[model samples]
Target: MRYTDEELEVMLSNYRQLRSQLKDIRESIMVPHVIQDTNVGGSSSGFISNPTEMTAIRLAEDDVLNEIKNIGLAIENTYALLPKHKQKMMMAYFIDREPNIKELEVARRLFIDRTTLWRWKHQIISMYQIELEKLDSV
Candidate 1:
């Protein structure tokens, strides 16, 4: 949803609050190893292999967790730039991307009637190109 300047302020505030909470959750957390590897991959029949598979897996897991945080930030920033009514729908749609979220689910989250949600989704998409252009110019 593209929000107006006023809406952007509110969304930015929301974003900051959410991020603060995330920070606390992140700090108290530690990556626990459920499994350990004893053999360091080597010749092992001279086949293709990674010795530090566990380490690689651990790093990949961290990467995915980081990606989640990054996506949240991106969504919030993008939301700030959208028009007011469109922001919720756009954010909802993004949230629902892949495996598709039910329309009702999106509507409930935004607390808007379904009809209004659909209308705004379309309206915002129609304005999407222009908004992208504006962002690009900036």
Candidate 2:
């Protein structure tokens, strides 16, 4: 599927957020919860389970996981179509969080000048737009 630049950015942001959420969800699911015994006065004791809430959390996690998978696939498909340099640039800037680094630092890491890095960023975005258009046409 094709996406506009804004749409793609939003999807990527959502993907990142969902990933963090999935981590939290997995942690929550893994840890066992303690249940207080309600029949302390009686001879028998039983633990109460809230199936509804448990089921809801599981279902929500499943949905988020599926969406994350789909978004990843879409990203991979697009990345596969890019040239090696573009792929590396995209990975560095987006996936690897290089953009968060200082401009000079990122440029040094990529072995490019700061001005060229900025230029390549624009070119890469344009390439993505063209690629997305091609995918849409298909």
Candidate 3:
């Protein structure tokens, strides 16, 4: 289905958010938990049983992973349809998270003036709208 610009923006935001969450997800998955030990008379047995908590965690992780994959694919497909310059603009301005670089810095890195960067951003959005329309028609 074709998405609107707002929808696309939201998707992109979600993709970024999900990517940020991956570290926490990995940590959760890697956390080690000990199974409860059972003792009978003078014998102690170490038995590992699949706990519901772990199962729930795994299921949640899978859901998040699947969503991340789906969103990443959608973003990639749309991004690939853009021209190289537009792609670079999108990556620098939206995708790449360089905490130290502001928007003007990104423009400078791309060798374009701030005004040109703004203009290109609008043009890229228009191009993206056209691309999304085409996808919807297909």
Error of 2 at 117 (Å): 1.5
- Measured by TM-score, how close is model 1 to the native structure? 0.35
Clashes of each: 7, 0, 0
TM-score per model over all chains = 0.35, 0.46, 0.47
Ten contiguous residues minimizing lDDT sum, candidate 1? 28-37
Residue ranges of candidate 3 with Cα displaced over 4 Å = 1-16, 19-70, 126-138
Candidate 2 wrongly placed segments (more than 4 Å): 1-71, 98-100, 130-138
How far off is residue 127 in model 2, in Å? 3.2
**Candidate 1 error regions (>4 Å):** 1-78, 83-85, 95-98, 133-138
Q: Which candidate is the best by TM-score?
A: 3
**What lDDT does candidate 3 reach at residue 77?**
71
TM-score head-to-head 1 vs 3, winner: 3
For candidate 1, write residues 9-124 as lDDT tens digits: 34333544556655654543433433443456764543225635644555556643554364355545566777776765675554433336677777888898889877776555
Error of 1 at 135 (Å): 6.7
lDDT against the true structure, per candidate, is 0.53, 0.62, 0.66
Judged by lDDT against the true structure, how good is candidate 1?
0.53
Can you list the residue pairs that collide in candidate 2? none
